[model samples]
Target: MTPRISALLAGLLVLTACSAGSTPAPSPTSSPAASPTAVQPASGPAITISGMTFTSPSAVAPGATITVTNSDSVEHSVTADTGNAFDVEVDGKGTATFTAPTQPGTYPYHCTYHPSMHGQLIVG
Candidate 1:
């Protein structure tokens, strides 16, 4: 084959090999499966924090005893961004509880120490 044809065939073979070896990305779905430790609504619901993650559903009812257990090596807090309605802190490997807001609204919370750690508490 000519020099140009040989180069084109080599490029095609490389592209084919790359695509065959690559993994296809996961498809978008309507909903994702809940984690094993995700908590459900009840009289007194509890959530665990590990690796700076709030391991629970984002929504909960009002007037519930929302417990927060911190299993990390560093201290973390869940302080409400709305008027300081509910703020709770748990030391390393410690646990704390706070009452949910009586009003029906979304309360955005974050860790005071680490601003990157945040989640919303939807009270309805």
Candidate 2:
């Protein structure tokens, strides 16, 4: 065969071989990153730990139970920043509660494990 005709035949063979294969796979779709759940409003006296932050209602009644939940992957605890007012520990994906102080004032608190994690409890 002529050099030109041979090249044309080789190109046709390559095209035929490629088309003989199975159907192509579908492209994968990207998924959204997981997000932490919203902090549930404190029904009465409760403190929640989500996204590595402590959250509480504006004010809680004295002598009431204060619930704390740690939703992060690491352990965290609630410790009174002053006077040793209250100390509670909640493991990773765990829940715990402590009784509110009797005095009516703002009680500052923090995570003993994480100094940057802090919050305040208003007793009134």
Candidate 3:
């Protein structure tokens, strides 16, 4: 009876050991690297003031650079009622650039050559 019991215990231990060894270890291929992330930087908007009137955008963005292009044959100037003004005396197909004020306000401006050619820029 002792010999039979010892034999059964040995068989159980051997089976357990075999099962543990047979189980496969996790493979490196099964795991993957963490996904990469994309980051974008914050930037200010742009405004293009052209033609007999403001082109591309009629309104001006605060703290943005306002670029004025004179496509007409006559010379034009940007004069604001609040004393914030810029002169753009360019020949036909010429271009000029000016920086808009950071302060938020309403500015009414017009071309000195043609008073009727008026426009308004609202900056916030």
Quick one: best lDDT, which candidate? 2
Question: lDDT for every model?
Answer: 0.83, 0.86, 0.64
Candidate 3 lDDT score at position 52: 68
- Higher-ranked by TM-score: 1 or 2: 2
Which pairs clash inside model 2?
A: none
**Sorted by lDDT, highest first, which candidate order results?**
2, 1, 3
Residue pairs in candidate 3 whose N, alpha carbon or C atoms collide under 3 angstroms: none
* Candidate 3 residue lDDT tens string, 31-88: 2443245345433433334556654355566767766667676677766755754445
Instruction: Please identify model 1 stretches exceeding 4 Å from their true place.
Output: 1-43
Deviation (Å) of 47 in candidate 2 = 0.8
Q: Please give the lDDT score for candidate 1.
A: 0.83
Instruction: Give me candidate 2's TM-score against the actual structure.
Output: 0.64
Q: What is the lDDT of residue 11 in candidate 2?
A: 100
Better of 1 and 2 by lDDT: 2
Q: Estimate each model's TM-score.
A: 0.61, 0.64, 0.51
Residue-level lDDT for 93 in candidate 1: 98
The residue pairs in collision within model 1 are none
| Tens digits of per-residue lDDT for model 2, 23-46 | 977445523233255355556577
Whole-model alpha-carbon lDDT for candidate 2 = 0.86
